[model samples]
Target: MAFTLSIPRKRISASPGQIVTALIIALFLAVFLLIPTGTVIYTAFTEKGTGALTAINFIDFFNTELFRRSFFNSVYVAGMSVVWATVIALPLAVLTTRFDFRGSMIIQTLGFIPLIMPPFVGAVAMQLLFGRNGTVNLLLNDWFGFRIPFMEGLNGVIFVQSLHYFPFILINLSASLRNIDRSMEEAAQNLGSSGFRLFRRIVFPLAMPGYLAGASLVFVKVFDDLATPLLLNVKDMLAPQAYLRVTSVGLTDPMGYVIAVILIVVSIFAMWLSAVAMRGKDYSTVQRGGGGLTKRKLTKRESLVAYATVGFILLLVLSPHIGLLLLSFATVWSYSPLPDGYTVAHYTRVFGESSLYIKNTLIYVSLAGLIDVIVGSAIAYLVLRTKLIGRRWLDWAATSALAIPGVVLGIGYLRTFYNIPLPDGTPLATLWVMLVLALAIRRLPYALRACYAALQQVSISLEEAAENLGATKQRTIRRIVLPLMTGGLLAGFVTSFATAAVELSATLMLIQSNSDAPIAYGLYVFMQSPAGRGPGAALGVIAVILVGLCTFLSHYVIERRQKTLGAAK
Candidate 1:
C-alpha cells in the first residue's frame, strides 16, 4: 500500500539521428512538394490584379465557352479512354491467365512494351501508323477501299492514350486473376455456372480491387496528360489549355492556375473514389499456399483463335516502335505506306549538331536518379525502421507527387521560382538545376515505391543484430541494410533515369533556352518542324535504346539478387 504511488514512465524517444532524418524529410517535402503545390492553389484563388481571394477565376473558367469545352472534353476523353482500356485489358488478362496457351509469356511481355515509350514520343510514331495517310490507313484503303479515323481529332487522343495505358489494367488484372481462390470458381461451376456467367458473377467481382485501381490511375493520367494531347494537336483539353494559358498569357494568368487546381482535384477525387469503392469489402481469399485458379488447356480451335487474337493485338501495340525505327532512317515518309528513301543522315545530324541534347540528358537524368535513390532510401528507412511519429506522412507526401500533373508542377515552379535569383544573378527559373529538380520531383514516386518495396522485404532482425553488436544506426544502415537494398536502389535509379529522360510537360515549361533543353524538349522542338522529323525520330530511337538497355539491366540485377537470396536460404 505504501509503494503503490508509482509514476508511469514516458516512452523512450526517437534517436537523435532519427529525429534529424525526420526533420530533413519534412523540410524536403515542404520545400519541394507542399510549397509549390500551395503556390498553385494560392494563385488559383487570388484575384489576378489585386492579390485578394475571389471566385472570379473559377467563375470565368465556367463562363468561358472554350474553357468549358476544354473541361468537358477532358472528362469525355478520360472516360472513353478508361472504358476502351478496360475493354482491351480485361480480355487480354483473361486469355493469358485463365487459359494455357503457347506464347503467353510473349503476350505478357508485349503488354509491358508500351510503358517503355513515353506517350508523347509514341504519339508522333502512332500518327505515322494510324494517321489519315499512314500505314494502317493505306492498307485499309487497298484492302477494303476505306479508312477508319482512328487518329482523328479527339478520337486520336483517346486511341493513343488507351493503347499507352491499357497495360496498367492488364498487369493489375492479371495479378488479381492469379491470386483468386480456385475453390470459389469450382463452387460456382458446381452450381451450373460456366463461361461468361462464371466470370461475370464470381471471378470479375473478386478482381474488382485491381481493376478499379488500374482504372483510376488511367483516368487520372489521361486527365492530366499534356504531352499526348499537345503532340496529337488536340488542344481542347484541360491539360493543354493550362499549358497554353501559362505560356501565352504569362504566369499571372489566373485561368491557368484555375485549370491546374481542377486537374489536381479530379485526380485526387478519382483516387479517393477507387479507395472508397474497395473499402469494407473483403476480397481476400483463405488459401495460403495452395493452388490458385485452375488454368484450362485450350482446344485446337481455341488455341488458334487465341494466338491469332493476341498476335493481332501485339502487332498494334508494337506498331509505335516499328514506326519510330522506320521514321528515323527515312529520307521522306509522307503520304506512303513505307519510307521513300532510307539513310543514316538523320542519326549523323542528331549526333553532329544536337549532340548537346544527349550530353544534357546524361548529366541531368543521372543526377536526378542519384538524388532519387538517396531520398527514397532515407524515406523508406524512416517509415519502415524508426518509431518516429508522422513518418508515414513523408511517404504519403512523396507518393502524392504521382497525382500532380507534370504541367501543373511546371507551372507551379515557373510561378514560385520566377523571381528568385540564382548565384549567377539569373532567375532560378532559367537554371539547368530547375529542370533537373523538376524531373526528380516528377519521378520520385517511382523510385520511392521501388525502394520501399525492397526495404519491406528486408528482415528487421538484421538491423537489430547490428545495433546489438554496438554499431551506430548510420553505420548499421550503411554496412547492412544498404548492401541488401543495392539491387532495388539500382533498379529505382534506372527507372527514374529512363522515365526522367523522356519527361516533356515540366521540361517544356521550365526550358528557358534551347541550349539547356533535355532530350525530351529537343525531340519536341524537332518534331514541330516537318523537315526535322528525321532527326526527331533518330533522337527518339536513341532514347528507346537507352530505356530498353536500362530495363534489361534492371531485370538482370533483380534476377541475380533473387537467385542469390534463394541460394543463401
Candidate 2:
C-alpha cells in the first residue's frame, strides 16, 4: 500500500555532504540560539534563593509607571509610523511602478538607501537638522527673528523613524501593485468605473496581501526599535527605559525584564503575521506585460506634475542627510548652507579620543558577519530546502528577530543572560557574547536572504545527481551545494559584516566599560560629550569609512562570484 524509500519518483537521492552541512547548521542554531533562549526563559521563571516560579516580577512590571508610559508610547509610535510610512510609500510605489516617471531608477535607488542604513543613523541625522539648536532653527531665528522647536520628543521620533522605515512599504507595495493584473483594472474602467473606484474595488484587494506583509514588517520594525527614541530623547517610549533599568539599574529588577519580554513577544507575533500574510504571494506584476510595466505615458502637462512630485520626494528624503553633513562640519551651531566656520576638529577628537572604537567596530562586524553567513545559510536551508519536521519554526525564530527592536533585544538579552547561573554558580557574562549575539540576531534577515537567493537558483535535480552516484549526502553537499552557494555565501558575509559595523541600539546596551564598545555606540557617546562636536564627527567619519570599505568588499566579492558563475556556465 505504501511506497518504499528505495524507489524514487525521479531518481531521488540525498546530495553528497548534505548530512554534514545540515549538522553544521543544526549545531549553529543549538549553540547561539537554543542555549541563550533557554537560559533567558529559565532565569525569568525561577528566583535565586528559593528556585521557585514567580509571577511577582510580572506583577511588579505592571505596577511600574515607567513601563506603563513606555508601553503606551511604543504602541502609539508604532501605529503613527505605520500610517506615515504608508502615506509616503503608497503614492511613491504607485507612481514609480504603475505609471511612467522621469528619473524612476534614481528615485527607486534613493528609496532603498533608508532601507539599507540602520534607523539610528536616521535619528542622528534628524537631530543635526531639526533639533532645538539645529541648522533649521538657527536660520529661522536669524532670518525670521523666531525659532521653532520642530524636534519635539515623541513627535520627533515618529517623524524621523517613519521616513527611515517607509522604504519597506514603498519597496513591498511596488512589488504588490506591480503584480496586479492590468486586464482586471482595464476591464473595470470599461464598465464605467473611474480611477478611484477601479483601484478601491479591483487593485486594492489584489494588492492586499503584499500590503499586509509590508505593513506587518513595518509594525514589527517600529515596535522593536530602541535607538530612535533614545537619540530623539523621547522619555515616553518603553525600549530604552527598559534597557536602562536593567543595565544602568540592575538585572534582578525583574520589572524591567518583564517589559522587555513583552516587547519581544509583541514584535515576534507581528512578524509571524507578516510571514503568514505574504506566503506564496509575488508582487512584481502590477505592470501589464512581461517586458515592463503597463504604463500610460503622461501628456506634457502631466509630465511636469510628475516631475514636481518626484522633486518633493527627493527633498524630503535628502534634506536630513544633507543637513547632517553640514552640522558635522559646522563650527558654530545653527549655521547656513555653508557653515560660518568649518574645521576638521570633530574628526580629530573622535580618532584621537577613542580610536579603539574603530578597531572594535571592524572586529565585531567581521566576526559577527562570518557567524551570520555560516549560521544564516544553514537556517535558510533548513527552512527552504529540507524535509525536516518543524523546519518552519526555525524560520520563525530567525525571522522573528527581525521583529524584535534592537533596544528590546538588548534589554531582553541583558535581563535574560545576566541572571543565568554559570559554572561555580556565578554570573557568566561579558560584552563579547552580548555583542556577537546582538549583531548576529539582528542581521539574521540578511543571512537568510543570501541562502534564499542561492537555494532558489540550485534546482533539486543537481543535488539529486550528486546523490544518485552513491555519494553520501554530506559529501555530495560539500562538493556540489556548498560550491554552488558560494556567491550567496560571499554576499551574505559582506552584508552581515557591513550591517554589524553600524549596528547601534543593542550594541549600546551590550557594551561594557573597558570591554567592548562598537564605533557606532562610541560615536553616540562622544556626540553628546563635552569635547564638543569635534570627536563625534570624527567617530562618524571613521564609522562611515569602515562601513563603506566593508560594503565595497562585500560588493566586490559578490561581483567576483557572479563572474565565476558566468565562466563556469
Candidate 3:
C-alpha cells in the first residue's frame, strides 16, 4: 500500500529542422554580431603597444576636453531631439487618430516622407535652405534685417535630426492611439475627466509604451548618427569623433576604440531605459471585439486650425526635398532665394557617371533583403512556433544590432576581418560580399520584428490541423504558414531593402573602390565637393524615389492581403 507510483518523465524536444534552424541562427549571430562586438570591446580595453589590459584609453577619453564636449553635445542633442520630436509627433497623433479631419491621411503620408529620406542626404539641402547666406536667411535679412542661425553647428545637427526622426514617434504613437479601447476614455469622461486631463491620466499613459519605444529609437539614432553631423561640420559629436579617430589615427588608435565603446554603451543604455520604463505596466486593453478609440468630428474652427497646423508642419518637413530638387537642377544656387538656372544636366551626369553605384546598390540591397527575409522567417518560426530551447535568445541577439552604431560595427568589421582574405586574394573588407553581409546584419531586426508579429497573428490550430493530417512540420510551414505570412515577408523585405539602400556609415568604411560604392557613399562624396552638389542632389532624389515607391508598394500589398482575407471570411 505504501508503494510509490512509477512516474514517466516528459521529454522536451525540437524537430531536426527546428534544431538546425536554431543552430544556423545562433551561428549567424555569433559570427556577424557577437564576435565582431566582442572584438571591439576587447580592443577597447587592451593596450595597443604592450597588448596588456589597461584603463588608459578610457582615462584619456574622459580627460580630453574635446571628447568630453562631444559626449555632452551628443547627450544634449539626443535629449532635445526627443523632446522636439515628441512635441511634433504627439499633436499629429492626437489630431489624426482622435479627431476626424479632412486630409488626415495626407498628413500621415507627408509625415512619413522625412523617414524615407536619409538624414545625411537631406543635410546638404537643409544647409542650403537654412545656412547663413542661404535662402531662408537671405529672405529674413532682406525682409526684416534679421536672420536665424538654425544651421549653425550643433543646432543644425539637432534641427535636422529632429525633423528626420520625428516620424518614429508619430507612427508609433498613432498606432498606439488607434489601438486604445474607447471604453477607457468614455469611463474617464463619465467620471468628470475631460480634455487634457483625460489624455494625461488615461490616454497618454496607455500609449506610453509605444511613445517610449519610438523615443528611445530616435535617441539612439540621433546619438549614433555619423554622416549628418559630419556633413553639417559638427564633428565634435561622439559618432564623428569615433570615425575621425579611426580614419585619421589608424586602426591602432585606442581612443577610437574608446569612442566606439562609449557609443555602444550609450545606445544600449537608452534601449534598456525604454524597456525598463515599460516593465510591469498594464497598458493592455480589454476590448475583444476589435473596436478601438472612437474618433470625433472636429468643429469648424478646430478643423481650420488642424488643417493649417498640419499644412505648416508638412511644409517644414518637406523643405529638404524641395531644396534637394532645386539643388539638383540648379546651375548656380548659391546665396539666392531660388536657383539661378535649372537643367536636367545634373540627373544626366549622375546616371552617366555614377551608374555603377546605382547598380551595386540594387544588387547588394536586394540580396540583403532576401537574406533578411529568410533569416527573419526562420527566427520567427523558431521563436514563436517551436518549443526550441534558447530560441528567445536568438531574437535578442539579432535585435542587439540596433544598439550598435554603424561606425562601431564598421570598425569592428575592419579590425576583425582585415586580415581574412577572400578567394580572389583580396581582403574580405574589400569584397562586395562584406557590404551585403553588413547591410543584412544591420537590417535583420526590422524584418524579424515584422515576421514575428505576422506569425503571432496566425493560429496554432492551423499547424496542428496540418500535422494531424500527417504533414511534417516543415511541410506544414511551407504550405500553410509561408503563404499566410507572405504579406509580412514581402513588407519586411521591402523595408529592409529600402533602409539598406540608404545606409552610409558601414558602407562608407567597407566600400573598397569608387566602383563599388553605393548611392549613399556617392552622395556623400558629391556633397564633399562644391561642384558635385548638383549630381549628389540628383542621386539623393533617386534614392528617395526608390524608397517611396517601395514603401507604397508594401502598403498596397498588405492592404490587398487584408482585403483578400476579409473577403474569404
Report every candidate's CA lDDT: 0.89, 0.70, 0.90
Candidates sorted by lDDT, descending order?
Answer: 3, 1, 2
In model 1, the clashing pairs are none
- Tens-digit lDDT string for candidate 1 (241-339): 999999999898899999999999999999999999999999988788424788999999988888888877878778888898999999999889999
In model 3, residue pairs whose N, Cα or C atoms come closer than 3 Å (at least 3 residues apart or on different chains), thus clashing, are none
Give the number of the best model, judged by lDDT: 3
Q: What lDDT, from 0 to 1, does candidate 1 have?
A: 0.89
Q: Of the candidates numbered 2 and 3, which has the greater lDDT value?
A: 3
Superposed model 2: Cα runs more than 4 Å off: 1-27, 38-51, 138-149, 272-293, 334-338, 379-396, 412-427, 431-434, 460-479, 541-569
Task: Between candidates 1 and 3, name the one with more favorable TM-score.
Answer: 1
Weakest lDDT window of 10 consecutive positions for candidate 3:
8-17
Clashes of each: 0, 22, 0
lDDT of 3 at 20: 82
User: How many residue-pair clashes does candidate 1 contain?
Assistant: 0
